[model samples]
Target: MRTGNTTMRAPGALALAAVGVLVLAGCGAGGNNMTLATGSTGGTYYPLGGEIAQLWSDNIDDVNVSTQATGASVENLRLLDNGENELILAINGVAANAANGESDFADEPLANPDDVTLLGNVYPEVLQIVATEDSGIESVADLKGKRVDMGPPGSGTEVAARQLLESQGWDPESDVEAFNSTFEEATTKLSDGQVDAAVAILAVPAASIEQVATGGTDITMVEIAGEEADQLMEDNPSYSTMEIPEGTYQGQDQPVQTLTNWASLYSTSDLDEEVAHDLVQEMYEGADDIGHDVGDQLDAETATESRGPTDLHPGAERYYEEAGVLD
Candidate 1:
């Protein structure tokens, strides 16, 4: 865990400069400039966002798209509300929290939460709980009094982790020893015995988690299922049941039913409808390129799937209308 250095990293200047040029060249007289905010370089969002921006830059003649690496979910939603980024990849829970002024958003609520709307769903972010074999943490209840990394500050993983703890009647203030760090750092702590367990909300088969699994540390993937999982879904509109299939990780012999939510693309209400339409259309048209470059989660059907709790952006609505999907 990085001490006294928890602030989110700023966007790179060189990337911003290149996007400025692209905006100047590609935009029409009105100037359609946009930025897509993703997560840290280590996670799925950064690379996936880069591919999306590339698709938009190449196909949309009237808009210029650039990508920035951010702190994921909560930070991305805040950036979109503040006009720092036009589009963002956010977890459903974080988005819901921001809109409701709950959880991370409780301290500093968005000025106008409704101004943000969903463009499309990219993939499912699974709630993953990894613990060491010696820690004896086989389930959520075993986490009491144990040292746990709740994920990076302001991350959606933290939000999900907290929800799980609260559902189990454990107060984060007194029931557990909590640490805040990036999933990569937390994985190291778990391996070295500095932490007993680590909770992360990420796409399945995470490379960072996989790294620890192969690093000779005996690990266990804790199940977040059964009655508690059902209660969690009932309590949070953003959550849904998901499964981590057998063998997705090393020595995981059974499918773990867990909670999951979509990782979705969102846009501000201010975006020109036509520009938004073009962006969504081009993304779907170039779906195969994205699958080849990133993951297959952005396939046409999944891309256009209903983003629960995420209101469809009118611009995206326009595209879906033309594509004969949004009846």
Candidate 2:
């Protein structure tokens, strides 16, 4: 449906109707403009970033890519570190804490977090946490006092819901009242009871947690495995442990576990390695029109597998070293 625009400034008559759709998409004709950013308009990076910006403007030659929604992985790494986005769709643990400035870019980092690279691995995300089957939460130690939304302010679901509520010692601003919104206003404030839990970090049946598991409000999810998700993957090695299975939502039947990360595809090393190897080879040769299910986890043999702390984008490391899937 191509919807997004769930706020993050806009409104000045939709920012002059997004500057008249970037001057009828010409965006200054021959300059080969690009944008991308994405997130919110109910998650999974704005309809897979509007089908990967219309498959990189119908296959790159004179590029025009646009997309923009915003407030996703730490505001798409400060809009690709202020060059105002040339591509994004982040959350490889908030693009490795905005390239090592660490956790929510520790008080304003990234003015050039070594120009944020990487341009592949677009899947994994997970983390779910939902709640509201009367909010008895059922894990992640029952989300303390509860209200919770925790996403949207420079989200990666608010940097993994404030590091899984400071790895269970609480204090995510007074142990949960928190709201921040989006992910379709935290699934209509957790299906109208007005929040009791939310937390996202998407992909895998998360259309705002499938409208709070079929929208009649009896939701659940929670789980982040034993030993507190292995000490939150030993204190966030950009997190790991995934599962979610059991029918993947719609009152999710069993397999829960949790925590994952990898979303990927960013940009900045001032892009152009033959336009980041034709935007990672037309995003896995037009990953089946990116209709979403995380575009069946795009392939190129796992595209340099799970890249977390960035790097790679010498035009996607010369197209993953000429498609041998790089070493």
Name the weakest run of 10 consecutive residues (lDDT summed) in model 2.
1-10
Best by lDDT: 1
lDDT of each: 0.78, 0.77
Q: Pick the candidate with the highest TM-score.
A: 1
Candidate 1 positional error at 62, Å: 4.4
**1-327, model 2: which lDDT tens digit per residue?**
111211122122234446754321224555456667787788888888888777776666666676778787888788778866677888787787777898878888887887788888877888888888887888877788888888888788887888888887778999788988888878888888898888888888877888778879888888889888887788888787888789777877888888788788888776667767877888887788787887978887777665766787777877777778776
- For each candidate, give its TM-score against the true structure: 0.88, 0.33
For model 1, the run of ten residues with the poorest summed lDDT: 1-10
Q: Residue-wise lDDT of candidate 1 within 127-203, one digit each (tens)? A: 99999989999988899999999987777888888888888777987899999888778878988999999998888
* Model 2 Cα shift for residue 59 (angstroms): 24
Deviation from native of the Cα of residue 238 in model 2, angstroms = 18
| Cα-lDDT of candidate 2 | 0.77
Question: How close is each model in CA RMSD to the real structure?
Answer: 7.0, 17.3
Error of 1 at 200 (Å): 1.1
